[model samples]
Target: MTNRKPPLLILLGPTASGKTKLSVEIAKANRCEIISGDSMQVYRGMDVGTAKIKPEEMEGVPHHLLDIVDPDTPFSAADFQTIGKRLIDEIAARGKLPFIVGGTGLYIEALIYGYEFSEGGADPEFRKEQEAYFLEFGEQALHDRLREIDPASAERLHPRDSRRIIRALEVAHLTGVPLSEQLAKQTKESPYEVILIGLTLERNLLYKRIEERIDTMLANGLVEEVQILLDRGYSPSLVSMQGLGYKEIVPYLQGYSSYDEAVYLLKRNTRRFAKRQLSWFRHMKEIQWVDVTDSSNFSAHLSAINAIIAGKFA
Candidate 1:
């Protein structure tokens, strides 16, 4: 490890858990710039569904990695790590702190823990074969195949997570090794001296917040946003379109489902996603969790975090 300390702060939590607001506050206080950890927020014109921070809400805290990629372009975790690390270094070089904030656990972990991806190249032919297999045999058949190869990974991934499942299978087919084994072999010490601050709230309140956010998105022209993307020739099958709220509402836009049904499903899926995020972060032993159930007194949480940062950097 290098003797020089790298300044990086990570504020992470589930969706609708108030991470964005807290992160902005922390960044402004620390003279830091924010790098978003969200996978969807990287895509341009995905504002409403991704719940991207409005320009006014930023309060003059500069943010990087938001709206950088086109929706039709493929983005991967490895790509994010490469770009994120560069930005982190650039920020630190300027004598400012780097605040990484988002609810995407995989993206956050990739940046903090430093996962090494295989040097495997994408095989269009193999992807087509896997897509055909799913179309012919269904999702369960593919998941069962994954179970036979990597039971542990299969256990964690839901069957309906077609994207990851397909990627795993494609990797196995091309490399002749299970994807789990590849991930297992790849590890590195994080280059930064980092602090992980996780924000959470009561389950009931979090769910309520998610519902209200979905309602706000609908009212704020989320459907119109999706329609514009579609008009731009973006496929519904694209990875960007498959994001949480975006995918759920596509059918409604296509007249296959009622708007009410679409909103209900989006809220339900978002709640489930938040629960999964909480579970994932809970297992990371290094995190200092803040329960913001009573937002009336955020000072306690803020003070605790400041104390930790001072202890680490002093």
Candidate 2:
């Protein structure tokens, strides 16, 4: 039987893996309109920290879903799925290839696989109670609560990640199923003619890139950008603030950690986050992995990616 599903190209990898640059090249060549798969790039005024693509850097290719929300708004995988599907259809309707590009695994997974998140799974009161508990007892206690209900989730989440911890607990509380288990049971079926491409680098080289990216962010006013968000009355406790670059810098701005310490933590945490991203992608099925370690040969990499897309979509 011939599959007539809409074609969707996905370019994903860890932070600083050159997904942004490569996606742009491929998009321009392939008549593709790029929809950001990044969870953080959606936030307004968070450019430097998220490594958001600059206007001039876009090179005339249309990009969607960047700077769409305020810093205080909560954006979940379900939200990404809803908006992403709509954008993909819209782009496809306009006779452009729909390209999803970024490293946020959960959001990408939910969108492509059409993960169903039950409305009954959410309880505002339960969330409020967990937030109160986190405020009163600290993040470790909250994480400990998640550990009892969803050990796998706890194992993955850091103790300081109170928001995710609370979310895991809430999923268990309202749905009577651990968040990890629910995720594990998702039907990994896509409605689209999906092409999943992953960019990877050698571990040491990837870490070097991550560290260099952090340094570039710092040089480009990352601290000031974070301070501006704080000045706008966005609380550090907000989930958006807990993101990679923002979270590490908040402590320095608040005098909780020295600038050097904050930078050190940012580099270390970003490296760890990249490792987790690679781990998540490794577990996903059907990714055409490309080793982009030798970035000196840009044309070769672009050709390799285009060849992969042509094979799948032709």
Winner by lDDT: 2
Candidate 2 residue-wise lDDT at 239: 83
Q: Quick one: RMSD of model 1?
A: 2.4
Indicate the residue-level lDDT of 215 in model 2.
Answer: 90
- After superposition, the stretches of candidate 2 with alpha carbons farther than 4 Å from their true spots are 1-3, 123-125
- lDDT of candidate 2 at residue 23, scale 0 to 100: 91
What is the C-alpha lDDT profile of model 1 across 16-50, one tens digit per residue?
88888778878877888999999899999999999
What is the clash count for each candidate, in the order shown? 0, 0
Q: Pick the candidate with the highest TM-score.
A: 2
Tens-place lDDT digits, model 2, residues 164-245? 7877888889878898898889998789989999998899999999999999999999999999999999999888899999
Instruction: Please provide TM-scores, in order, for all candidate models, with all chains considered together.
Output: 0.91, 0.95
